[model samples]
Target: MDAAIESIRSFNRFFTRHVGAIDARFLDTDISLPEARLLFEIAQREPVAAQTLQAELGIDRGYLSRVIARFEQRGWIRRDRREGDGRIRSISLTEQGRAAFDQIDRRQRAAVAQDLAPLAELERDELVQALTKARLLLDPGAPMDFVIRPARTGEVSQIAARQSILYAASHGWGRALEVLEAETVAAFLRDFKPDREQCWVADLAGVIAGAVLLTDEGDGTARLRLLHVEPFARRRGIGDALVRSCVQFARDVGYDRIMLWTHTVLDAARRIYARHGFECIDVEMHSEFGDPVQGETWRLTLEA
Candidate 1:
């Protein structure tokens, strides 16, 4: 917990410094960061309630009142009484306020664009995904909308690399695991059958958050392989969604049953498989990945 807290604090400090949050005037504007943010939000939700602004911004009532009063003095904002409640006021940005908001918005956009200009397209997408994932982790209420599409060419190796890194960091697994994954993916692609095999990636924007591959295993059985979700992207239903996609694809392709191999240590993946009607059919102790682990085979029988 201490390490996690320090990491978060360090990131916060670095981000604030990089964005000039400590500056008296934000983005060389005439207002502080708080004031600029309030102005932008007001413009976004014009005729918004003062109470709503307070709730959204989590600012003290007195502080918000002072800010609103200052805006009124500057002729940048006007407040009108609600029809049913005279005490409740709706705030709107005046023409001058709109102009000020536009200027700040343009500057902010340009600043960010300039900062990202040096990054390649892939790197930029990765940065956006990382930022968005961090926001989602900190704010659970943040919406996460991702798509599960067929894996693109050259993406299989990326999936293998991500899964290998995640396992190595979390489970202390070695290069043997990565080698195994690479071989599995290689063979799956080498003997690819479009009609009987499929691979899907959970794409959060342009980022691949999770992936799964289904392969024909003969005798009307489909094998589910390389199921994984990025650490930052977990608990957002990406894993379960990928599993469901794989299962549905198997059923659609006339597979009689689906089977998958997983370690008992992976409780989350086990739970996802269980929720999808898979049952453990076999278990054995193995040290294939440099650790003695209970390897289990889970099977899901499809309805005819």
Candidate 2:
């Protein structure tokens, strides 16, 4: 076997042995491991549906039903049809079941604490730090595989509608949706030039995840506008990728700085801008569309 596979198998054996000791001491009842875990999960929620527990625990339906049936037969759990949802059955712990679970939970926590007692406080901290660093090293963010292409003529309308819905749902600004009209978006697309002002859409898996537009402000500065990402695509590093692409494009095209306007309500976008060395040089309270709002103007200086 490969060294990595051997290491994994060794770790699994060590873990199983460690857990088996506690299982022998605490699990005197006839309940199996799966049934005990199900009891703990169901006890945490009030009348939780079996399907919810299955999804959350990633257990197979057939196995989960068998375990639940055992618990039901032991008088440790009760199931009833949900109010107004006769088809959906909810599970809850009976009084006797709660007492059994309390005993099991205390034993589990005590066993875990005993196992960790060998490590000092500093050693535990070091272990956590090492694990976190390994995770980051293995999953460092990269420029996602995306194609930057000109916005399609039909896509402008859809983009505008989605943006409106997102902004309204997020910032509670219903009128902010009207700031970018369909005709204006169409004109922007129609007049895009690769050398001057341009709009590029980022497509991932045949879906437009984000977009950015760079327009020359005519004074050695480029206006970075329309940096938007779909809410579903948030935290996938799409926003950061779009911002970096725009910054690189600006620097390559002989621009001195890039500037953009955004609202303060969008903290995640602001953090991304700050991370890439963009400084908030100007901010003001103004009403551009309808209601008064706090807006921030960020600038990133490009190295000449």
Candidate 3:
């Protein structure tokens, strides 16, 4: 390995060891790291599927099965067949499991805070900024092998469905699904001309987790549209990849500025846009899909 890569790997090893020690000290539980992480995953969402655990953690199926079996044996979690899909079983935490997870969560936060306690507020901000810059520089369009291709015929519907379900479920936006009609989605997909517009779907490990669409405005501008990430696939940096892909596409296509419309309630999406230098250009109160939401328009200007 090159010197720089070697140095990074060495630092990573040290960091891992330091964090593991902190975890051991604070989380004072008998659970191992893998099991603790699994518990965390279970705690974060309801009815987390086994397949999701396997995909997110890159854990082997047999190992995951063993870990889950142990949790089941201990009455920490329960498994049941999904309502509509008898073949697919979903796992959820039991009352005892929830309590255990809460303990671990609190301890982990305390451990992290302790680790950062030595740094001053300004220093901590600088450290965070540096880490963010490094991540952007090192993994700019990453998880590469991510290719830009034509979206599948039914893909938009799937994307819209996932978006509606996630927003409604997480944000309490009632009847969000009703806003995503076939015609509206079809129009968005149809309007993208391959030569003037670009739509790319990100597939990590052969599963589509996110997508981005860019369309020329025919007025010296571009529209970034239909950016969606599945809830189960979040925090894997897939959203960042999708946003970067759209920004890069806009730059490549020689657009002077790129704009997108979204809601203020979508904090995660807003953060990704902010990281990409998109600034809010407009805001309005809008009632759509059965909710009164604050709509926001963001734009990013490209340098010559």
| lDDT per model vs. reference | 0.90, 0.76, 0.77
Which segments of candidate 1 are over 4 A away from where they belong?
1-18, 83-87, 133-141
Which scores better on TM-score, 1 or 2?
1
Instruction: Evaluate model 1: give its lDDT.
Output: 0.90
Q: Please, what is the TM-score per model?
A: 0.84, 0.51, 0.49
Error of 1 at 21 (Å): 2.8
In the range 176-270, model 1's lDDT, one tens digit per residue, is: 99999999999988999999999999987566878999999999999999999877677789998999998888888899999999999999999
Ranking by lDDT: 1, 3, 2
> Could you give the C-alpha RMSD of every candidate to the true structure, in order shown?
3.1, 18.8, 20.0
Alpha carbon lDDT at 275, candidate 3: 97
In model 1, the clashing pairs are: none
Instruction: Output the number of the lDDT-best candidate.
Output: 1
Candidate 2 stretches greater than 4 Å from native: 1-150, 181-187
lDDT by residue for model 3 (215-257), tens: 7787878888778775545667778888887787778867899
